[model samples]
Target: MPRARVSLLSLGSVRQGLRDSIRHLQSSSARASSTSPNEVEHSDFATEVEINDLPDGSAASERIAKAIGCSVNDLNAYFDPADPSTLSITAKSLKASPQMRTSLLEWRQNIPPISLRTERAKKAYRRPIGLNAAFEKALKVLTVDKHEKYERILRLTDKVEGIINQFNVKAIDEIPVQKKRSEAYLTAGLIRKLRIDAEINFPEVTSQFEMGKFDMRLPVYQHLVRARWEKNDRLLLIDRMESMHVIPDTLPTLYPQVDVKVRFPGTNTFWIDPGRVMSTGVTASEPKFSIQMFEDSTKLFTIVIVDPDTPDLLTDSYKTTLHYILSDISISGNSPLVDKANANELVSYLPPHPEKNSGYHRYAVWVFEQPNCEPLSTEKLASFDLQNRDSFDIRRFSQLYGLKAVGAHFWRNKYDSRTESVREKYGLPQGLVYSHKRYQHYEDYAWALPDLEVGDENKA
Candidate 1:
């Protein structure tokens, strides 16, 4: 009995210490010269937490309660009975260990099932308290190193759990999102469709998005690939999500600045070109464009294409095409082959071929001249090519180039809160929550893991 009590106290204290470390790092890492490993681990861990809505009647929860030798009512008491969406355990009231730290295994095996069920709620409540979220909040925490690196071990465990959850691993993945109610099975009786036996498994790419895994992003992009390579029973290649790593965008800086020329906005009849940049066309017959310069003041030209007819098998099926014309201000030449006189300027467009298509595909093409032009080599875009180059993979490119991507256009769903800027949706939302303290920027009960120091890196 004393051993059990000691285990509980150690678990609670270590949890508290971790929370303290995480909060401290999240709050002060930006201002401090150095940050603790505990802090970064917590932030990364918080991201992997799956906030799913638990059913009011969880057979699993009931079975767990029975396995632990606790009465149903006693088990329920330990969890939050009010919010059926979550089982919440209050960490604030728990007893702490005399040593004020706990081992990873203790919490996993010792914590009653009912107590585990309330983890989400407890985590939510403890966000402001500064726990090392990555250590304590994972579905399953495992490690061989537990000396001074206890915090990092915890963070890695969280990451491992998140990877498992992202790929929908049954026993390992425990985080739950909101439940979906789809009655489309009503058409089960009218089932008359082609059958395809397909196998799905998450492939280890970078550890986050397994190649074998099937997620919303994969299906959506595959649909785009189908539309792109239409007319064959070809298989589209999509990599796992783990290939994504957070890095600053680097392209916009290559040029001092370039003018943005608008040629055409997409229309109902035509979808935007994936290869060309959009420009405002002054006239339908002569087609004039409005140009805006970036910080470098280099004159740039653009072309736009809108193709509404592209088969949108996926819910997000609209497409925009961009064609960029960059001119080198240093070069001077007169050429009739091209309307632009700058010898340094080059025109590049995508969907590489438009004339070959028999169907009506709308495309916009605009030309602009920049004060200075920095040529982008093929090697710069090699990753994009490997990743299918075209599709919903726009964010990955913009992120790499440090370019403020002006979205061509996309289908809006009910869940989309248009109030947030596009950059926030694609790039900065997580950063915003992590960087700031005011809760108003985020939602109630929605807290971010504090900033953490990575490896031996000092605070920025």
Candidate 2:
């Protein structure tokens, strides 16, 4: 059984400790730091806890909750949300092992603000302002390999044909916006039809588009694959759902129990806290884990680790912030991540480290079974190459390549001193907290593991 949690900072000292920690931080850097691993506030944490930039306690509490992986409700149970000590105490309550707790502190300290990150994005990517988003999306969809592109063009052709058929006639005298949409769809449909015709070279239409013939058609960017999120509803404990069919339900049984362990620079590796809230420092590299397979060695698998919470928690406006994608594996009776060479790693595993002051996030790993296709063969998997990672949709990716959910699990991570650095590395936005104190209705219930044949592995 997991031990009952206790706070290291006393209530009487919390207020004072926070202030002292803040002052100590301001002396070190322009930012303010507040959390400590244990009762003793570490100087390393002082550099990372930047409360000075935060306007108030509401902001501080939100940051504390996210940084330590506790609900605002949980953090408040120990101290005022704004208090820096709230983070330290809340982490204590969660029983985060000492080494992981310290890494959380360090990770939080290293975070950079939006201004800096935006600046970094501008300098690093040099994304031309007038590059045309809609055109770019269309180009991405159209220019892929023959197999995938053929299917996409067909799907688009069908959709546009239906829309065009809905309009009894080409009402050229319609309003500007309406006419624009109609013409674009008509033109997009025409282009798809034309692409198949050997006589019409690609240059004619593209050259005409460059010359401003049916310019609106350039904006025809449609997602080819849209699959259901069957697992999101299970994660929905909120009183109300903002959008239906956005997230899926959670699986009760993590069929093949996966043990995810984090290696700390300070201490020995430990089994991840069953609760899954982790410090940013501990997540810099890909996590090492051992999976218990169901004696099926022939199956090929794909593992996608994604953070669906970005910019905020309630809605996935930013969609999934992909961290890792390892595909095409031959499970040899029970070997851990095999053949680093054979697997298709679309995105190298960047660890989860949410920005400071952002709401708590859910970082999940989804495992899909490539039953029919030779996932190992690059020739077979060529159709699945998504040129851009921004549009990566796991559900679509799974359905597109005939992969089904085999086994999956996820852990949570929030901001820490090293978070700023991680965010800077990924060119992410600064943490944003719209409101204070997310409810703790589910609280400790989130970690309930289902009973399996190996019963002992069920517990974290």
Candidate 3:
């Protein structure tokens, strides 16, 4: 019968039939490989509707029940918990049900494991080496048990928080009275002690406490501040002074033990950098001084600001002019801000007014510690008048007062557009513009000139 109904097929029809057969074979092989012999095959629809049943007293069942705050049997109808192989199925169920996910999260947060809490607390309060040995030993003796240590940390944290909240509102200027400031420093001292003894991170509280201490100039945190100055600012100041000849020109030498900061209030509120060039207008106003002393004991200090670039036409050399001088100034680690009320203004502030065509002038600020906190006599103070300020000798002044230089700072100024206005305001005389002088030269000898006639003859 097949021979009688034989039909000729085209090449295209044969290729299409072969492709269909290969595709069918691939599909069958894939279906067979998808399900292992041990695995039970279920329909996709059936899997979506199916629920795994949890056995009693299983670990997974207990965990799910605890997390969801429900009995294991109560949740058995909706999802599988005891079957370890149905993890993906349970995850999908949890993802689909927001109520279940939220409940599980709440349960976890409400009842964290005791072991985890202990481990976390220990890690958070771990002590670092290289700290003060005596302080660490004291802490160890006080907090022998974990519970004791944690409780102590909590108490100190509360105390520090209270102190910060109390003083954070008031500024340094607002708390002008010494008695109230002393009380604030006492509280800050307590915070410092806690920080050193606890040896634990206090995050925001520690930083706030430090800011308070710095503003109040408390001695408790002076070491940290001193260390910072010694490591960076001190070295930079020394380098600038030595390189610019401010050292020998102003003073013999400097061995700074304190940190000196200079700022012009109306012009710039920020502290001026060491050896920075300032405009005549910016330096016109009296500068604010902050002398950070490392010593705890209060002592009298003398601040001398001199310009070592003033021109003396008579001698054809530069003379050091006293720009400003304050005597009987009190300063210490616990009180760093310069108090002008208790100070004697030897020479009123004379703003820098460099002459036209003159180079940069160095305004050297020297802080000298007095021998016995003695005030300058009236005679000595009167001697530093405007006339006497023109030729000031710092070496002689320091020798007379028996003063030791503890801190030094300097800034530069040059003639600018505002120099004229400053000169007028200070009633200074007109500045003379200097020009380079030309010198006369002798005529050259006849033999020194080139022989033009001989060269012309050689060319011919």
Best by lDDT: 3
Q: Which portions of model 1 miss their true places by more than 4 Å?
A: 1-309, 314-316, 319-373, 386-392, 405-460
| Predictions in order: lDDT | 0.29, 0.47, 0.64
Error of 2 at 158 (Å): 54
Stretch of 10 with least lDDT, candidate 2:
219-228
Error of 2 at 277 (Å): 0.9
Clashes of each: 79, 28, 0
Residue pairs in candidate 3 whose N, alpha carbon or C atoms collide under 3 angstroms = none
lDDT of 1 by residue, 1-460 (tens): 0000000012243355456545544554364446446534433333332224223455534543444334556556545434434544446313322111121112222222222336675545422222344434321121112122335434444444444456464422132332210111112111111000011111121122223242322222233223433332111100100111101111111121222223333352343222322222211222223232211112222222222323221222344333333333332111112233443333343222221122333342322232123444456555445323233233344445333322121111111223233324334232121122333322331222234333312321
Error of 1 at 308 (Å): 7.4
TM-score of each: 0.19, 0.36, 0.55
Ranking of candidates on TM-score, top first: 3, 2, 1
**Selected candidate, larger TM-score, 1 vs 2:** 2
lDDT for each residue of candidate 3 in 1-460, tens digit (9 for 90 to 100): 0011111112243244335435644564586578554222122111222122224346666656554456777556554554533433346446644445544332222222223437667444422222223443444343343224334434544544444456563332234466655554554455445434432332332455455534323323555567668999999999999999998998989999889999997847999889999989999999999888764556788899999899765345799998888989988667778989978777789899898778999999999887656676667545545458878889988877678898999999999999999999989977877556522321212212244332343322
